[model samples]
Target: MEAKNPLILTVRLDERSQRFFNEMRIKYFPPERNLLDAHLTLFHQLPDTNETLEIVQNSKRGVFEMGVIKLINLGAGVAYKVDSQELESLRQDLKRAFADRLIPQDKHGFRAHITIQNKTTPEQARLLIAELSESFEPFTIIANGLDLWEYLGGPWKHRGYQSFNYLDK
Candidate 1:
């Protein structure tokens, strides 16, 4: 079988969101060798070839300014607090765009959470969540860019990401 052309997706992130993730990294997430940009992915697992090109070409253009909010506790090793309306709209638009090629299905029913770190032991996860909850307040962020990227591998291995497009608002 032909090697999958690195699972590609498009996304955007705001400054505050990025900072939050960075703080989480400094506090708990292990330093990664090849850390890519922080973004809220809009699409994933897109098939390859001309169809991918067309999809990218026809991708909708818009600006999303999402405010910072607590990412309340997400069960099963996830937590966050937010009721971001703009983020929700962007997500919906993405789902509509890639309805044919990629299916938007999350094992946990799409809980909006910025993944601080994956592959954590239950104890570590709990402790991290508690500490974050204690220190977490609320903030706001203005996102003015959209980007296209391809995942290099699951989440390990060097050269974890490759940027394809960076669209400004």
Candidate 2:
């Protein structure tokens, strides 16, 4: 990978929940353009450096349950809103560490979500949202760890995973 490529950090969901979301994403997202399975990104871009990897690996967040609380309309897509105060705290910790290097979007507030459909027409998105809402019920998913990825241009390559160790595994 190029040294200049950015890194992306995401919360790794449990296997069961991840499979469920991946299915939804595949069913709703445009197949031809979908680049990744469903995921909740914590940081969109971080300098590809050892310091970035070290900071993430040293995170102290424990495994926690995150609520897949709400279904949201992304105007041109659909997503599931996830919530966890613990997750927010983790983001704050990393945000402070990368204070000077943060991009505009990462500098602002962070909202956790996993998009199921995107890059589609608003009308198509609305229809999917309506269909999903009819059967949607809030659920909780386990956040097992952090996933560090090397962003090569627009594609991502998984680098490593740092599992949360607060609870016995």
Candidate 3:
């Protein structure tokens, strides 16, 4: 079962970046797209609120600037890739600070991607992925704050991610 309060994670993205994503939605992912806005997802929720708040409050805030990377299809869905060295460092710092709350372990193999759509078949998905991957270009954005969002569920529930809190970084 999904968490009662839902699985919350911290993400950072600006209005410009958000707009770019929205345009992409029109040309690529549409209504019932089952896609999420682009952002860097930090650590997930911890069972204990006291511990979670303490860790987040005490954690060092670091600015992350990411170069735009195209979403590539890996036989699943499309995702944005973050190739910036500095951003990776921030990711590592977050992993270390939220060691216990980390939903997935840190690994050498990581790419920042936002799934744009859900397809019925893998073959059809591959075709669309190829087109998007080729058309995407590099964009740059800076992340200065952390936002906590909860995933409600389903492709139709994309906007259901409501911010629970914000932390300046």
- Which one is best on TM-score? 2
Query: Where is model 2 more than 4 Å wrong at Cα?
Result: 1-3, 167-169
1 versus 2: better lDDT goes to: 2
lDDT of 3: 0.55
Decoy 3 TM-score against native = 0.68
Tens-place lDDT digits, model 3, residues 35-64: 566445554443435555555455455556
State model 2's lDDT: 0.90
What would the per-residue lDDT of candidate 1 be over residues 42-122, giving only the tens digit for each residue?
455665556565555555545555555765433334444445676566556656666676655521144455556545567
Models sorted by lDDT, best on top: 2, 3, 1
- RMSD, one per candidate, in order: 4.8, 2.0, 5.0
Off by over 4 Å in 1: 32-37, 53-62, 72-82, 104-109, 155-169
lDDT of 2 by residue, 7-45 (tens): 899999999999999999999999987889799998998
Root mean square deviation (Cα) for candidate 2: 2.0
lDDT of model 1 at residue 38? 43
Q: Provide the TM-score for each candidate, comma-separated.
A: 0.68, 0.95, 0.68
